[model samples]
Target: MNTIDEFNIDVRALNVLLAVLDTGSVSAAAVRLGVSQSAVSHTLDRLRQSLGDPLFVKSGRGITPTRYTLQAGPHVRQLVGELRSLSVGPPFSPDEAELTFTVAANDYQRDLLLPPLMASLRETAPGIRLQVMPSGIPNPEMLRKDVCDLVISPHPPAVGDVMQRRLLDDHMTVFYDADQREAPESLADYLQSRHIGILFATGERMALEASLSTQGLSRDVAVTVSNFSGLPAFLKSTDLLATAPYRMKDHLLKGFQRAPLPFELKPFTLLMLWHQRNHEDPAHRWLRQQLIDVAQGLES
Candidate 1:
């Protein structure tokens, strides 16, 4: 008998053995694994030498497993099943879960959705903890470097491993202090007015400004702030017009009058992003669904 270590058999070789035994032929097993027929034959030969058995023999036009191979088939299948199961995480139960997750979001998203997300989690998953940080001009590294589990933003990083879904859509609207002045009368008036713009600390303009730039339009910014939270202070009792998402009317820019933009622009969608590695994780999926539900509930 040969020592099993001398042959160095691994899970792939074991799968090949089981494939041939199940299909009753080497060629069929190769087709199953997308390998060449000779490759299957070579694996069987090494497995046969390691086990001291002629695992298969010709049976008329096809092949049949020998008595030893037949006896070991079920055990090989079980071993392979157990080895494959190692890749998956254990089961998750939100009620009993004790986990912490970080989410990257700007003030608009932080105020709009996260409060509802927290309220929902408190009712269903009290054991989980949340740590939220600013997601200004979100980048793929936030997920790749484990900085955060999720990012809520209009911009999605241009990386293949990053995945995103639109949480909700909002159109650019003219926000103004009704007591100070009314919305701009026309495109010319809108373009000429003093505008309040959001410019992140890193010097990147927000999505609305960036998108407008692509279409050869620009804002005459008399005031610029680092976040959406600061826009309200600058717009009060002033003729300054701030073009922002209409959804903000009930949240950050409450009591401000809203009117449709005088010019045509595509509606911007707020998106949620995550790393591909967590796409199938049980806990991640649960939280992701929770966030989506909150966004959807707001939409409805």
Candidate 2:
């Protein structure tokens, strides 16, 4: 007979077990974790020996969590959360601390906000590295899933175990090429001219379009692009217009010119979001404050 006191249990094993439980299959869990099924099976084997119970059982085409797993699942998830929180120590010195953070933002936010923020971080927190992922729309679960440390967007998650701060708000303005087409001086001219629509990956219309629809007004959208980065290619030589936030005026509209929207539209607010798990972490709090400071400086 083999004893259960041979191996040490770690958080990675716990996470592997929870992934298996949540996915209901070792292969599926492996796919989610970017690991091999054999590795997941090995982790499960070790966990079974240590816990003195088979946490899962094969059932026909798939597997099901056993009674032990049913009871321990919630506690294991909580344990993983607590373990993650331990990374941010109480004494945080930006000059001496080394850390890596991931952020998600679309092209507009990425271009408008990150350059200045990076300059500040390089000057103050030289040891920190920032990775930015493209954000299609606001999804707070990225923080809960530990995929990113922060998310910047106009549409923040409305309800969740997350904290959000209003960074700044900007009104909508139409950007057009002055050399190709004159600025629209009236509502009819704005609506009749060809426009470039910025649609997200999910096929969701922008808030600007929604505002126009509410007023029974619509633009003649000739082309649709996924982000603001694609607009310059189409707008520079053609008679196309792009309605975007005014904050992008300095960075996104260098050769282009902006004009007031012919119709009234509500200003959109950009928000910074982080998980509640990081709410009290000193390092995370410091980074969040730095972002807020950067945004305030731009606003002023």
Query: What are the per-residue Cα lDDT tens digits for candidate 2 across 1-300?
Result: 246466568989998987788668899789767899999999999888888888898899888988989998878878778887787656889998799989899888899888888999999999998999987776655876788999998886764356799998888899999988899999999999999998877687788888888888888999999877888888888889988777777887667888999987878889999976687688888999999998999889
* Clash count for each candidate, listed in order shown: 0, 0
Q: How close is candidate 2 to the true structure, as a TM-score?
A: 0.71
Task: Give me the displacement of residue 286 in model 1, in angstroms.
Answer: 0.3
Residue 8 C-alpha lDDT in model 2: 66
Model 2: worst 10 consecutive residues (lDDT sum)? 1-10
Total backbone collisions, model 2? 0
lDDT against the true structure, per candidate, is 0.86, 0.85
User: Candidate 2, 235: how far from true, in Å?
Assistant: 0.9
Model 2 error, position 261 (Å): 0.3
Look at candidate 1 and tell me the lDDT of residue 127. 97
For model 2, what is the error of residue 99's alpha carbon versus the real structure, in angstroms, after optimal superposition? 0.8
